[model samples]
Target: MEFSFSNSQKMIQKEVRRFAQEELAPQYSRWDREKQYPRELLRKMGSLGFIGTSVSQENGGLGESYITEGIICEEIARGDCSLPMATHVAGHLCAGLLEHGSQEVRDAFLAPLLAGEMIPAFCLTEPGSGTDAVAMQTSAEKKGAAYILNGEKSGITAIMDADVSLVFAKTDPAAGAKGVSCFVVPRNLPGVTMQGYEDLGCNAVVRGSLFLENVEIPASYLIGEEGTGFKMAMRGFDISRILLCLEAISPALVSLEETMAHVKKRVAFGRPLATFEGVSFPIVEHLSLLEAVRLLCYKALWLRDQGRSSSKEAGMVKWMAPRFATNAIRDCMLLHGHYGYTKEYPLEQRLRDVLAIEIADGTSQVSKLVVQREVMGREFLPYNYR
Candidate 1:
């Protein structure tokens, strides 16, 4: 199997890395401190065709491969973990919805989202529901040519600045997962309101609650066939989790590089800290894990590009990468001594950002269940036996 990136992919990596370093890295701290969304920078990225890497050219996107999308996410997170949220919203969430959405839905939303003129949010998790998405209380009642939606979606990322949202609500609650349907809801709709949260990290893309109080949207806003929202959302996560893994791990990789340089030059006692086994071994271990996880991420993406099922590999990395990266970043922070604990260094922030990934798309516990279900057959799932 080929292990290296193609020339074009390498170019994408170099360009994204340069852009992230020059544009995102400098302003990340300020944005995080102010809890601001970097809309203008995201527009810049869209202009450069970085925001919609997997979208087709006809849809105002770069039409690059999934591997290219992962590369962009990795480089963006390497510079500033919070910034890649824009890519996640634009590339994974919006693009995935557009793929399954009706022509009318795509016509109204896709272009502007690809252009970064509008930001999109995905609403699935609710106040009482997360891992068990089918338990959502949100309901969309059909009324002639429209649907009236009423419920609160909690812990929704990018909700604070989203111009539109892909919301899932139950149309037939008795049908369980099959009862759910997806809708493209505009932020300016009469009954739609939002409240931002004070999250621990990745503050640039604020998490928030979406309160849909009898929000009305035309029937044409529905995505795909009725009762397929759960499957569509899961498919979107299958694509997104891989990118999220990259987002979580890349920052730690950055921290490792920075720490490596510091330890090699900064002397402790009679020699540099790099000379010590305790200092050096952890770095080696983290580096190895990072490389392995990164490769798995690419493999999953490559499998997707080939139209193969990668849910198993995706689940593996989704659980492994974030947890490992969090530990790695924590290790790097401790190695930095007192400096790492302070806000002056990015290590502390990186740790916080990576920590969020552990719970973002899916928790490690849930991801392991997904991997188990895939490996050991669906009959072996806890819920199945229970």
Candidate 2:
């Protein structure tokens, strides 16, 4: 019913937009070119409490609503899309896991993570398994008061710089999905090793592989009970998928804005480029499409803020936002003519970064199946069985 942000939400939005544009936008491409992780800037964001919005105020977080979280994510992304990999959805997942962690775990890890003094990585996907997370080969064997973790987690964001990792491994392999347990494993453990990747976009994120060879940790490091990790991860995904969509939307909207300004001023054949229906209409269409999805993104966040299930809406926008945002950015690039293709402009990089959204969090195919299962009932799911 309410269509506008609250006074507090608006205040947060204004500040975030200013910080993002002033501090983040200038170096957006610099990090990409230098392949740097922007750790110092991340610390700055943390010092300003911009990194993780979900932590409780008592826990040194703002305890803001999911709607507020989306606002920050979208605005920060407007300035630089790649940084949210460390601050938004994935950051939330790390926070969510730590929220359920034991007090000692929270004291040692969560505090620094929220403060931006430390980087956190969520380890769920491995080189050999992702969608079928139950089939993961990572294992944690309990011995005495400790658990020895051994596995390789690939395609992880900020792995190279992460001070800690929420590692997923099967404590009881025979229990299938139920056997999986989450652990708060320090990335600097004796047995841990890492290698960075040469990714196509979001190069600043430094996505890489994590190899744990007999990594040992106290048994208290296990998050929740054994076999509950899968559900915890899935629950976090419901909101994270929505956040990822908003991240994609931010850059697309910014790209469109850049294109809009260029077309309005650039003249062709004695007429402004914006005067052409071909030029103006596509801009209008992209704006309209993105606005609709943007509203849906917030709606999903609102439902989450209400403590209601938003998986259906999350799945719907998860696929649509990235697919549409990428299209809009690509068109924006084309509309900019030769200038768009060059790295001098942000369009090409925006296009490349947005393209990664189509695959991150969840693939378009998997997202559709999530919606299918939700809307049509589990009985109709392709993998559903009585």
Candidate 3:
């Protein structure tokens, strides 16, 4: 019931806020415009432990609380609003695989990833499969001491720049979800190829398709037990969705703050825009929604830290926050008039950046299905049979 951040958490928020404004805010627009990934800045963040907020200290990370990780994502998104936060979330997913990966896998991949010397991508979605992860077509056939991987992954974030990928493929195609397994595949492996996509937003992260043709990797690269990939991925999504919600909402909050200052000073029809109920009311409503969803995100993270199930809370925020953010930013842009629509201001970019989050972790409809299953019991699920 207590709702207050500890001194350490507050300190983390302040430090990250300061760093984000000073470093990321200045270059984000250019990066987005040029569709360039800020690898150098990411390395700096990794060196400072910002990239590994939720990772264990033993793995060369900060070993911070999940709430701290949420705060970090919020503050960073408040600045760049896209690529850095996406990359951070992707890194966290990779960290989860490392947690379950073998020591050799950790030493070979996790160490460099934590150090920011390398970037990793998470590949779960396929050309034919997204929400129905059990329907994935990617397969890895056991061959002696190795697995020959041959399949394609679509909508994989940061695939173009990633040195390693955490891939999910079927080891027993007929076993359905039980057939799936997770593997850490290096980009240098034979028959590994990638092609980038031109996205509507989040251009800097540059999502792409991954092609694995007769790719061979040692069986030791497999993470955890075979046939548990779907379960592990769902658990990771429970954590990532909360962080993704924070990232989506923080930029809208920042835009609102900026608009508030402008509305108070900019005159319209012989009065400041803030004096008009039309302008002020919508801003106030958005402010309230942002605050509410932000708290929901923190609550989810808190539950995670307490080792409690928060699937319902996570799904609620994941679906609601991004939709709220996109609408909120759009209103803020309109309030600014022509100035907001132009590239001269960051609001337009903010609009573009947040819109992508609606589809990133889970679609709004998919998240609602998650909440429905939790509340109405698994038997009531849409996919359940009579």
Backbone collisions counted per model: 0, 0, 0
Please give, for residues 142-244, the per-residue lDDT of candidate 2 as tens digits.
Answer: 9999999998998898888888999999998888888999999897789999999999999899989999999999999999898999989999999999999
Q: Candidate 3: list runs displaced more than 4 Å.
A: none
Q: Give a tens-digit lDDT track for model 3, residues 77-191.
A: 9888886555565568888777788889988888778777888999999999998878989999999999999999999888999899999999998988889999989999889
Clashing pairs in 2: none
State the local distance difference test value for candidate 2.
0.89
Q: What pairs collide in candidate 1?
A: none
State the RMSD for candidate 2. Answer: 1.2
Instruction: Give the whole-model CA lDDT for all candidates, comma-separated.
Output: 0.89, 0.89, 0.88
Candidate 2 total steric clashes: 0
